[model samples]
Target: MMEYFYPEHLKKMFTNRKRELKDLEYTRDSLDKGTLRNISFFGLRRIGKSLLIKEFMYRNPGNIYINIEEIASSPEFFSLRYIGYIAYWLNENGDALPDDYMEINALIKKCTEMNIKALTDAVTKLNLEFSKEKRDHNFLLGLAFTLPEKICREKNKKIMLFLDEFQALAVLKKSPQVLNPFALFRSAIQNQSGTSYVLAGSQITKMRSILEDHKEPLFLQFNVLNIEPFTREDTYELCSKILPGQDTDIFESIYKYSYGHPFHTTSVCERVKEYSEKCELEITNELISQAFLVEVLSKEGNINKFCRYLYDISLEKARGYGILKAILTVLAEKEGTTITEIARGIKRSPQATKKYLMWLEEVDLITKYEKTYFYKDPVFRTWLAYYEKGIELGIMPKREMLKNLLSNLEEKYLRTSSELGRAKEFETKVKLEKKLGIELKNYMSKDGQIEIDLAGKKDALIYLVEIKWKNKSSDYKDIENFLKKTEKSEFSDKEKKLFFISKSGFTSSALKLAKSNNVTVLDRNLEAIEAVN
Candidate 1:
């Protein structure tokens, strides 16, 4: 009974879909003018196909929308149900009926006057089962088509009917009736001067085959439009509008996790509301980490819901998925690792790795640069790193899942001390760059010989900082060897300001070396130590 920060309109909160909406509207307008007849709105599940069409109908009240999945049986039943719906709409509005309704009814009645005739016709035409469902379905569609023209004439208004999840209805072609009423409907509405048809479905392949492929009856019948995710700016705007004062990072995290999928974003935000309420501190990295890692992936949450979705994908694909995930896990910890490096890390052949990478790319789950691949959505990466494999591979029970996840969280938090120091050292360099009027560059040298964690330059002066978590006093030999290594490297022309960063204070020997080498030691734990200008 808890609610999070989802848009109240559910998927209707879709904004910045102007291009898609305009294309759809343009198609509808063309149909009103009797120029366009068949249109298909197709995409993956929860990609806003249904909601988009529903919103379209809201603007065009005269339009009729039918959920084909709910009514699908046979071609006849499919037609009849829609016809019945049309009749209900007309009668409620006090609209006049078509003069030849009876005539069309009688024409369809001959197709299935009795069980024997229905089976006989089905056998010869479709080689399908002799079912009453097929007969009723065919008859209904036959009636449904006739009513559209009648309604147009009676009301003197145009009608646009959206066939929802039409892929399911397309299946009845396997029946004895071979009821391809969609094709017939296309013919009926084509330039009928008043009727327009919008065919929409969530199953990407099925809908694509129905309306986009040339072989299908409704092929190339309508404009094809794919709904995409909101941009980072739009998502941030949406989150700000709905949940004021929320951290921009939280919204950024949502966008990264949901890949800007509205449903997924809202799904996460809804929970974020609960998590925010339960916690006293304002939403921060720690709060989000706890909420997402401990709360959402908890046994009581929807981790199993996520599992069911993955279960539907093929097993080979799933294994490839695990390997891809392992690659990302390595990359997350060791940023900028190349493809050859990833192949070694995942222990898969480059050829095999490429295939997995492509699959993830196709699904918008990951991105590849030249040959290297990284998780496209950070939240998905978080989910994969924290929740996915453990649940899928049965590495732990539901309770243990939370425990291990929290354990990893603790380890990451502890590890941050080291990374944070490095980050702050870079931040200080930025400040120093402004003060010194120079630019700074961070370089990762190959051959594992020379590495500069942070560097900044101005004119002929260059400052270099090396980060170390160990106490400086204990690192005298390491510091000497590091300087010796750097001193041996090739350099073009710039004065170097070498610096050593350590948690522990510098030893007399290292400080002496730094002084002699013209290197400065700035211990990270001691931030008050300003740059020796």
Candidate 2:
């Protein structure tokens, strides 16, 4: 079994939440002044909401803690189930519940014991009774407050009631009778002379839906405090304990991987501690990389779950997404390209392509490059490229560009390697111009075509190469079309070198033709393609 590294410093411990502590303190003070009763806490999952309540109970020994999520198993087990649980808690804690508790429990038990016909009659009367003067929910909630009073009276001190995941109880409100009971409970808390409630939950959506929604049973009736994730500084402080001599770079790396997500950050640190026991190296990029790859990336289901949601969308939407993904893949790889160019690559008009772009951005799956619109997000792009094969045809603008560049290069410099073998009678002019550089003012005659791949300019020599990942052989027509484009376009007649790269070796004829034309033919195994910065 792996021992989890639970850091003591600046973790999601109750002591660290200054704002939450202050807010709860204010609530306690109000309760002491006999002015406040209900308070709500909301945040994302595993954010220490339950822990905060437990801490509050630790400080106040005279408090009753009830987690509604645990007690309320189904909608049918409403007041009676809650009453039964309270009865059990009271019996185990000290003695019998007060008169109000006994009274509510007996009443609910009687309603349950009655036959179907009698139960219906009783419910009808209870509804009328509640509608006329509000139900006796106060008695049940009053039980919570009364317990504190009872304890305070015995111990000569005040008590508090901590109800965790209280939102689960609100599910009962779906029934009219259950809802009436809530109003009475609310009234009881509102008029509680002594006890205070610290309600909390890990489910932010459900909690808000129940408590914050105005149309719901409990709305605007409680003060709310939301727990935020730890800041970068706090995370750094916690990490420093486990990583004694680690530098700021390690902290930055941790933040990058975790994005200040408390659970994720802590989990990584726990793994790091385990790794450090064997490895002597201090925390570095390499170590962090290993941690991410081994501990986090090794868990694949997380990303698969996100993609599964996209898969569940309508087929048309999915296809549109495929098109969106491919275009974004190209855009992401190239950083940014003209919108028109993206449309042309995808075989769609600019207007058609813009719609899908808007939809993707709306969902936050991808983002634009500010003034320039480019697509990015490696996972999304990769998912689209692999899963949505049908739509990629639109995303790749340079579909034939790679093949054309390869053929052109083969014609120009296909025999450079062979010529080197016969160096005794040959002079080589195949210069390795800046392993990578940019070219500009290279002529292109057509409006939408005819741009030279590489050019030797004074400022930045361009070394454009085509990428072919799929096709093993280039078609002659592609090469012919490129030549025709170059001849017709009005591009600069500057000295330039063309290079072609393919996933597979070029055709024999294309290779010979390229050598005659002074083109450089590169096989799939081109070394260090990213040699140029």
Candidate 3:
């Protein structure tokens, strides 16, 4: 069994990421066929990018894993770790080596024992250079980066190079010893035939700039793969593993509150498990909510600390930290607000507010769609809302305060649900366009009180659609309401065909009613609406 870089417990707790794993495996297979395709994994922090990489490494041994954030404190340290990791992976049983193997002398001794003279000699020379009064930075970086490919060719072995938090390499440039680190790195790795690189970063914006920005040296050099949050099913599966035999509703609530974020889902479940064991309570929605609150609001909580770190670190990277925070606070209060509205809220001019908003976007704290800005992580926004309200640790929140927080959470959930509904409508629109081969426009009345989910003109007739994404089946009354709305709308005078799409299918009464009214009803099983001749 290959020793996992992550702890055994965490490895055991790892849940579904089959798609990402398959994608990684494809890269590995390509490498086996003598083709190297570098990949870049980018996502929000704690979104399992590192875990996914470690899992891939565990499945495919003989790989080098380096967390640049851990080792990129200085040029020399980074070079040493780079050499050490290469040597560590090269050894037949490197995991058994003493912890000091990270040191140059230990690595040199180990490489000598393994008969990897190329690496040993390189490490020795690098060690000697470091001791000198004047060191050539380019020589050190060039030697460190190219060592793997050199060693790989020497031993006739393929290597997978995983660089977690790879964006930290930019920090090395602050040192005179490592200027233009990314360009130098790109230069060294561009020709590595035997080593495939899988770079991952928690800072999405920086990673995209490094890999996708046209001006960057490494532009279009690596295939970008975004590690998304776990799905609702994955969240439930993980929660069940943490607290087995729990009700479906409990897991649903966990998915709802955690929004399928792996770390948050895990934290919420662990907290719930602790409370259940200590207080001898059954798992309930209220308990889950409290666990979430404790995880987010308690000072000693992991998520709280993480949010604080993220807030501080992100602002540290961007200019106008103070005003950036003010902008974040405004977004936390009312997300999806336009920059002009935000400027008014912050009492700043539009241009200044736009600059601050750009700073926030640069840091990946918020994203802009059209003219409105929204927090990239809604859970973080919720935390900020509570944090701004002074929800202190060591003291229970007052009843009124808890009530207010819950109310706010409920309102936010409703807004999120509405957004999801809109997403479903969009998905339906796309499917309709592809199925019917016609572009559809969303229909809304002048007063905006009446709206059709989708409408398009096909074969001299107008097709109107009403989508129901609720948990329950669309009932007879639902179809009746749709017909009434269409009848009262501006399109009433037009020859319109009616269509109903339901997520959970339709009730028998609803189906019969649709048939009698010449309406087409499609459920989840129905792929597309048939075009009437």
Ranking by lDDT: 3, 1, 2
Flag regions of model 3 displaced more than 4 Å: 1-4, 92-98, 393-401, 412-415, 418-533
- Can you list the residue pairs that collide in candidate 3? none
Best by TM-score: 3
lDDT of 2 by residue, 405-477 (tens): 3343234322222211111111111222334433322233223245543334444333334334444575444
Work out the TM-score per prediction.
0.53, 0.45, 0.78
lDDT for each residue of candidate 1 in 337-437, tens digit (9 for 90 to 100): 56777778888887787776665555545567665566553444455555544533231235555567656645542222232233344345555567556
| Model 1 lDDT-worst window of ten | 93-102
Q: lDDT score of model 3?
A: 0.80
Clash number for each model: 16, 26, 0
**Sort by TM-score, top down from the best:** 3, 1, 2
lDDT assessment of candidate 2: 0.50
Tell me the tens digit of each residue's lDDT in model 3 across 65-149: 8888988877777889888877776664235543556887777777768887678778888989989998888788888888888
Ten residues in sequence with the least summed lDDT for candidate 2: 420-429
- Deviating ranges (above 4 Å) for candidate 1: 1-14, 31-34, 75-77, 87-137, 179-188, 279-281, 294-296, 299-310, 313-388, 392-533
